[model samples]
Target: MDEVEIVVAHAERATLRVGDVFLKVDVDRARAEAEAEAMALVPVPTPRILWHRPPVLAVAALPGATLGRLGGPVTGSPTAWAAAGAAIRQLHDAPLPSRTGRAGRSVAEVVAELDRECAALVAEGILPADLVARNRRVAETALRPWTPAFTHGDLQIAHLFLDGDRVTGIIDWSEAGRGDPLYDLATFTLGHEEHLGDVLAGYGPGRDVDLDVIRAWWSLRSLVAIRWLATHGFDPHAPGCEVDVLRARM
Candidate 1:
C-alpha cells in the first residue's frame, strides 16, 4: 500500500506519526495533568510517540488479533481477575505526586456531574432522562461513608490484556482517577458475577466491600453504558451482559 488508511478510534484523545511533530490536544493535556499525580502505569504494546511538539501518543498496533477472536471467558478466570486486581492495588498505593493538585471533587460532585450528564442525555433524546432520578436516592444512600481509592474510572475486559490465565497488562489509563475503588470493582462485576468473585478473592478480605454501594453503582453505570452503546450501534441484548441485567433490576 502506498499510504496506510488509519482510523483513529474511540477514546483516543490524540494521534501522530512516529516522527511527526505533535500538537496539543485536550486528551494530551489531561494525561499530562494525571501523570504528575500518578505512577506511570505498566507498559503495553501500543506505540507511544514521545518527542512531538506538544507530544502525541500513537498506540501500538494490534497484532492481527482482535477481542472477538480471543474467544470466551478470559474475563472469568480467577487468576486473570486477581492479577487485574493486584495491578489496581499497586496503582492505588502509589505515592501522590508532589506536583499533583488537590484530589478530584467529592462523591457529591460526581453525582452532580452525573445529574448534568443525564440531563444532557435526555435533552438529546439519547436515554431515559429519569434514570438519574430513579437511582439518585440509592446513589445518595450508598455514598454515605464512601471510601475513596484509586479508580481506573473505566475498567472492563476490553481495557485489559491477558495471556492465558495471567494478566500481562491493563490498557487505557485515559480514565484513571482517584475515586471509590469499589467503583472499579462494581464496574468489573456488573455483568460478570463469576469474574467479580474471582477479583474479590484475589483482592482478599482486607478490601472493605459494600455490596449495597456496588449495587447502586451497577444501576447507574449500566444506564450510562446503555447510552454509550446506543451512540455506537452495539446490541443491547446478549447473555451474561451486565447492562441488560442491571437495567432489568433497576
Candidate 2:
C-alpha cells in the first residue's frame, strides 16, 4: 500500500495501517496492554504482534477481508460464517485470562445503562418512544444470570476476518475478557441475523443456549450504542446500521 490507510479513528483511539503493519493508538495504556495479553491467551487466529508501547500497539496485518461491517453487505459464505462461529466458541471455551476486566461491567450495570440510554433516546427524540420501549422489553430476556466465560466483549463482524471457509483472524482484543458468552454471540450476529443459524450450527449443540437472551442482547446493544456512535462521527441511522437493527425489533 502506497498511502497510509486509516482503519478506524475516534477521540479515544485510532487505528492506522501502513503497508502490512497495523498501528493501534489508544488513550489508555492499560487497555492496550490488556489487548495484547488477551490475544496471547486466546486459542484462535490473531495478527502477529509486532511491538507495543504505551498508547500504541503494532501488529502485522492478517491476510483476509472482514466477514462484514455493520452497514455492509454479506461477503463471507455460510461456511465462512460457521468457521467464524467455531473460532469464537474456541476462544470462549479457553480459560479466562488473568488480567481480564477491560470492560468489567456487571449485568446490573448493563441493565441500568440500557435503561438510561432508552429514556434518553425517546426523550431527546432520537428514536420513537414506542420503538425504544418495545425493544427495552425485548432486551430484558438477557438480564438473567449467566456464566461468565472468556468473551470477546465486542465480537462484531469488523473484528472477524475470513478466508474462504476458514476463520483467518479475530482481531481487536481490547474487549476480550470474562463476560457473558451470549453477549459475544449476540454482538457477532447483531445486524446479520440471517446467518445466525450457521453460527449456531458451528457453535455446537452441546451447550444449551437461550434464543430469547440473544435477541434481548440485540436490543440492549443497539439501544446503548446509538448515542456513542453518533457522537463518534458514525452514522448509526444509516441503512443496515445500528438504527436499522433497532428498527428490526419493531
Candidate 3:
C-alpha cells in the first residue's frame, strides 16, 4: 500500500516502486505497445508484463548513472558521440512490426501540430511560448523524404543508458514508431550537435538520412520543453550555450 520513489516516465505515468514490485501505472495500452516494440528492437531494460488483467510491467532497476549524468560526451568527443550514433543507426535499421498496426505521423506534420499548439497558447495570452520554428525548419529540411525506416519518436539522452563506452540499454518506447531512419539521429544532433557528426560518422555512410524531418521533430521538442518549463514555473529562457542554438531557430 506504500509507494516508493517515483521517477518520471511519460505524461501522467510514473514508474512507481511498491515494496519490491516496480509498477508502471497509467496508459496501459500505450505502455503495452511500447514494451512489445522495445523487445523487438534492442536489448534494453524496459518493463515486462507482470499481470494482464490489471496490466502491470515489471522492470529491472538500472543500477548505473545515465549517460547524461556522466558528464555526457564532453562536446567534441568522438567516442561517446560515435557510439551513440551507432546505437541509433542500429535502432533505426531494425524492423518495427508494431508500428505496422498503428497510424504514423510524418515529422513535418508533428512539427506543424506543435506550432499550432504554441500559436494557440500565444493567442490565449500565454507568456513564454516556444518559438523554435526556424530551428525546426533547418532540421526538417535536412530530414525530408525520410527513409521508410523505424524511428524512435523521442530519442534523447535522458532515455538512453550507457555503461562506459557501450550502450547498455535504452528506455522510454512510448514514442517509438515507423518513419525515416534519421529521426533518432536528428534527435541526438539537436542535443549534441558538436558530437552528432561523430555519431553519424561512426554509424557509417550510404544510409540516407532525412535531416528536414529530424529538424521538425527537434523543433517540436524544443517547443514542448519551453511549455513544460513555463508550466512548471521554471526558466523558459535559460542562458546557456544550447539555449542559443535553440533560440536562433525560433
Candidate 4:
C-alpha cells in the first residue's frame, strides 16, 4: 500500500496524495460535486476524476510540475507562462456554464468579504492600518460592473500544470464560475508581477487588460487574504509573497 502524503489541510478542506491519486476532501460535498462538473465544462485539461464519494473526490494526478508557487522560484519558462495565459483565455472564452449553484461571488459579496477581512486584519494587527487603507483604495478599481466570463475563481500560480511549453492541465475547479476575467488574471499573476506582460501577450494584448484594475485586484486579494493566511499557518510576509506585493504597490 502506498503511504498517504498530506498535500494540504485546513479547517474547511484537505487534500491527500497516495501515489498517483489525489483525494480532495471538502466539508461541503456540493463543492466537490461542482468541481467535477466544472472540470467537465472547462476547455482546458483538468485532472481525471477517478471517483467522487461525497467528502472525498479522487483524481489521477496529471503530468508535469506546477507552473510555480507564491514565494518560490518559477520552474516554468516564458513560453510556458504564455501558454498558461492562452489556456486561461481559452477557459474564459468557453461557454458560460449555467450558474446553477456552480460557484460564484457577486461583486457585492466580494466587497463585503473584503471589507470584513480588512477590518479583522487591521484590528488583529496582522497588517498595518495604513497599508490596509492604501490597498483598499487600490482595490476599488475592481469593484465596478464587469461582463461575466467563466472564471477560475482561484487561479493560483500552482494550479496550472505545464509540460514543456504546453499547458498540460489545470487543477482545482471548486471555485469555477462566471466572474470578472481580470480577477483570474490577477490571481494567476499575483506576487509575480514581472510575468504580467508575458501572460497578456499570450492572452492577446489588444484585448486590453486595464493595468489599474489588475493592480487593484492585487491589492484587494492581498489585503483580503492576509489574515486568513496568517491564521492558517501560512506566511504572507515571506519574500515575493503577499506583503511584498503590497509594499511594492506603495
lDDT of 3 at 200: 73
Where in model 4 is the C-alpha error above 4 Å? 100-104, 205-208
Model 1 C-alpha lDDT per residue in residues 187-207, reported as the tens digit of each score: 666666556666766676666
Indicate whether candidate 1 or candidate 3 has the larger lDDT: 3
Model 3: lDDT equals 0.57
- TM-scores for every predicted model: 0.68, 0.96, 0.73, 0.95
Tell me the tens digit of each residue's lDDT in model 4 across 126-216: 7888888888989999888777789888999899998898988999998888878898999999988899988888898545589899999
Model 3 lDDT per residue over 160-236, tens place: 66666676667666667776566566655665555656777778877865454555555555554655655654454
Residue pairs with colliding backbones in model 2 are none
**Ranking according to TM-score, highest score first:** 2, 4, 3, 1
User: Distance from true position, residue 231, model 2, in Å?
Assistant: 0.5
Clashes of each: 3, 0, 13, 0
Per-model lDDT: 0.53, 0.87, 0.57, 0.87
Those runs of model 2 whose alpha carbons end farther than 4 Å from true positions after fitting are 100-104
Candidate 3 stretches with Cα past 4 Å from truth are 1-3, 9-11, 17-22, 41-55, 69-77, 100-104, 124-143, 210-216, 228-245
Best by TM-score: 2
Candidate 2 has a TM-score of 0.96
